[model samples]
Target: MRTTLWALPVVLSIGLGTGSLAQQRSVTTVGSVMQLMDAMTIPASNAVFNVGRQPPETDEEWSALALSAVVLAESGNLLLIRDRARDEAAWTEASQAMVEAGAAALGAVEARDVDALLDAGDVVFGSCEACHATYLKRE
Candidate 1:
């Protein structure tokens, strides 16, 4: 009887902890794949792309630029999520490209190099184009 009383609380705590673990991973996207891209990836990537045209002038602008690059990098991970990935090989390649492009953009932002940003922008756009051509082309 004494052992059961102690075990009961432990079991209940374990169950509660498991439930919270599931809640913590709340990014399981339920929307259409395109919607996810439109909502997050496209906008974040565009911010990086557009910054090349008008370079950041202030600390605040630089912060925003960095954040946009971070978002773009993280968006690639989002695409690789099991629920979002279409083809294992192709999706992995495309998402990895996004990650690499975002990293380049972030590095350029850190260095405040307009030319490098332009190069990174080309990479970012090309990555998106390649992926879309293969997997996301509208039928």
Candidate 2:
């Protein structure tokens, strides 16, 4: 019983993060966004890791699709705080690619087209690689 009680919120926070945890966690908006981004990455990593053997995404895969959308939304919101035109423009380009990647995934989930799914992967990769090139710098 105690285990169940403790587990409930943890389970919910997997898909929901703006409630009780927001207060006690000392988490800023930026932290919350980072958490959300982390959530998105898990499924994406799984999908890509299992690329060859996995079934194409489907409407039932809405969980992953939602994760991607949430990440992209946070990215768009970050644009509001960009300190320079170049930064804003770079983020804009990446955000667009993120959107295209997500939209393609959503469409592939509904349509079950492997080709479209592959294309979505490419767009996602392009945005990530491009942004990393400019901001992250290679190790």
Candidate 3:
């Protein structure tokens, strides 16, 4: 019984580890980078930026802001997907900046602070500009 129990745990661990590896290997991009930017990142960042001009008043408004911030933050992860990443070093740095700026926006929204949201918006804009300058093709 003791030996069986120990072996069972080992078997389960190996099975779970294999499943995890499989999931990692299967990670794929669903949308093109432009699609993701247009659908998620741009709108979300716009929401954060607009808060400076028209601060959220109702709970529902605040909740919407929260959702936008979350989408923005998660969009950074989407950019980091292996298929979407343009390069290793600069791409990773830019994506991480997006994540951090989004997080800051989320924090500001939670606090109901318009000024802080504006500051975070600036950071988000700077991150976007930095990445676009390096990667975006103008032609």
Candidate 4:
């Protein structure tokens, strides 16, 4: 009877602890990787892509450019989140590349430099393509 009582509490405690851990694991609010790319990355990057070809003329337009760069940079970090990374090293490298490219774009936008913005766009596109080629399995 003593052992039974003692073991019951131990088992219950472990069960409760694991249950909490499982709940914590399920707390990923960000949708799947594809959803993030479609909803956030694509739209934000479009803003950056439009910069040189259709340069921002107003403060509002410039603000949008800056916002896009910020989104891109942050989204790169988002890709590095647990379970989202396809391969740790490759994924980290690609995500860091995106951050660098986004930073470059932000710098160009701040400077209002069309040439630099265009170059930044190219870098951003290249980084995205490389990452996609490695991980994205198109259906």
Which candidate has the highest TM-score of all?
3
TM-score of each: 0.75, 0.54, 0.82, 0.76
Clashing pairs in 1: none
Tens-place lDDT per residue, model 2, 2-47, is: 9999998787886466543433554334434345346554455346
Candidate 3 whole-model C-alpha lDDT, 0 to 1: 0.89
Candidate 3 residue-wise lDDT, 1-139, digit = tens: 9999879978779779786443367787789999999999999999988886889999999999999999999899889877688887888788889999999999998998888899999999988998998999899
Number of clashing pairs per prediction, in order: 0, 0, 0, 0
Which candidate, 2 or 4, would have the higher lDDT against the true structure? 4
Looking at model 4, how many pairs of residues clash? 0
Where is model 3 more than 4 Å wrong at Cα? 1-23
Q: Write the per-residue lDDT of candidate 4 for residues 1-139, one digit (tens) a residue.
A: 9999889978779779786444356547559887989887899899998876689999999998899999998889788766777676777898889989999999999998889999999999988998988887889
Q: Which residue pairs show collisions in model 2?
A: none
Ranking by TM-score: 3, 4, 1, 2
Q: Give candidate 4's TM-score.
A: 0.76
In model 3, how large is the Cα lDDT of residue 26? 73
Which portions of model 1 miss their true places by more than 4 Å? 1-27
